[model samples]
Target: MKIGELANRSGLTPSRIRFYERIGLLKAVDRKANGYRSYPAEAVTILGLIALAQGAGFSLDEIRALLPADLEHWEHDALAGALTRKVADIETLQARLARSKAHLLHVIDEIEARPDDIDCATNARRVLTRLLGEDAEMPVASLRAKQF
Candidate 1:
């Protein structure tokens, strides 16, 4: 089929299809005598898989590495290993994000706990003390020197 039909069938833009072809991800394409791109019916399926993989956090390079030259044959063990590694990577990221979210929530709570009579600097010191221990009481110049 033509590029337009392939784009419609694959739910991808013409430019994206062209980009995939250019990047060596979509290999089952041919050039017609009239200079139009001709794609096999399987191109639709290939494009779908590429999109799915991307949604699952696979980079284009990773997808290219995972894609078999011939759709009929796959290196099952390699595929399984790569998928397992990706899952682990995602889990690590989730844990880090959860910690970051919790830290932000804690900071928000501290900032909101300011007393009516205390000045802004006092409240800032109180929050910093709660977060950074006695080090929050150190002089600004001392902190700057310590940073280096």
Candidate 2:
């Protein structure tokens, strides 16, 4: 098939297909006498795999490393290792994000729990003291000047 047909089948733009070819993600194409790029039937499947891998958070370089020049000779061990590492990286990111979310929620709770009589500066100081240690003394004037 031609480049247009391949792009249509793969659900990618012509520019994207060309980009993949330039970046060495897609293998070289055969050119017809009229200078039209010719692609094999397997090109559509490869493009779909590239799109899927990108959606799964794999970078183009990472995808390139995962895929071989010849689709028939895939490196199973390397692919498995890359998948394991990506999962571990995602888990670590999730843990960090959870911690950040918890900290934000705690801060929100502290702000909401402030007494009616307490001023904004005093509440800010109290919240800051709770977040940081009691040893960290921030001036009420500075706290009042800053927005949340």
Candidate 3:
């Protein structure tokens, strides 16, 4: 089919499909006598897989490396290894995100624990001390300068 029909069937924009072709990801394309792009039926399936792989955190380069030259043939060991590595990367990211979330919660708790007796400046200092330990002793002017 033509680019428009392929885009409609694949749920991808024509520009995006052209971009994939430019980047050497979508290879099953031909130019007809009328100088329009023609795509095989398999292009739709390939585009779908590309979208799914991107959603699953596969970079375009990674997807290109993983895609088989022939659809019917895949290097099973390579595919399995790449997937295992991606899982490990995701687990590491999850651990880091959990740590960041815990730190943010701790900061929120400190900010919310302000005593009525203390002024805003004092409460801010107190929260900063709890959050930053020894580093919180730096003068506010110096902290402001460092931020810039």
Candidate 4:
């Protein structure tokens, strides 16, 4: 198939496919005598895998690492370990997301409880400081105003 055909089949843009090739996430296809890019049927599966990896929040660099090495040279155990670690990382992300959502809800409740004239700038600073310690970046107004 041509690049366009592969792209259509993979549901990825030709430019994105080209970019993946350029980045080493996807290998370049052979060119025809006319100098047009000629993709093999397997390129579709490779592109689909790339899309799946990206959807999982794996960076292109990470995806490159995930690519299977020549089995003749690389051990299957290494790939298994990489996948295991990826699963663990995803679990950590889910836990962190849940915590962040809970914290945001708490902030909303605090904001709602504050009096109108008083700025919550101080409260914001306290939250930031508690989360990031004294080294947290804070605006000057956060020190003076109780509300913002």
Lowest lDDT sum, 10 consecutive residues, model 4, at: 67-76
Query: Where does candidate 4 stray beyond 4 Å?
Result: 69-75, 115-148
> Model 4, 41-145: lDDT tens per residue?
778878887788778777888778877532234446866786788899999988978877887787677656666655679777555666446547656666444
TM-score versus the correct structure, for each prediction? 0.86, 0.82, 0.88, 0.70
Report model 1's TM-score to 2 decimal places: 0.86
Across 23-108, the per-residue lDDT of candidate 3 in tens digits comes to 98999899999899999999998999899989989999999999887588889999999999999989998997898798779878
Find the candidate with the highest TM-score and give its number.
3
Q: How many backbone overlaps does candidate 4 show?
A: 4
Clashes of each: 0, 0, 0, 4
lDDT of 1 by residue, 1-148 (tens): 9999998999999999999999999999999888999999999999999999999999999999999997999999999999999999999989978987997799899989999999989999898888768777788777666521
Ordered by TM-score, highest first, the candidates read 3, 1, 2, 4
Residue clash pairs of candidate 4: 119-146, 119-147, 119-148, 120-147
lDDT of each: 0.91, 0.87, 0.88, 0.74
* Residue pairs whose backbone atoms clash in candidate 3: none
Candidate 1 global CA lDDT score: 0.91
Off by over 4 Å in 2: 134-148
Better of 1 and 3 by lDDT: 1
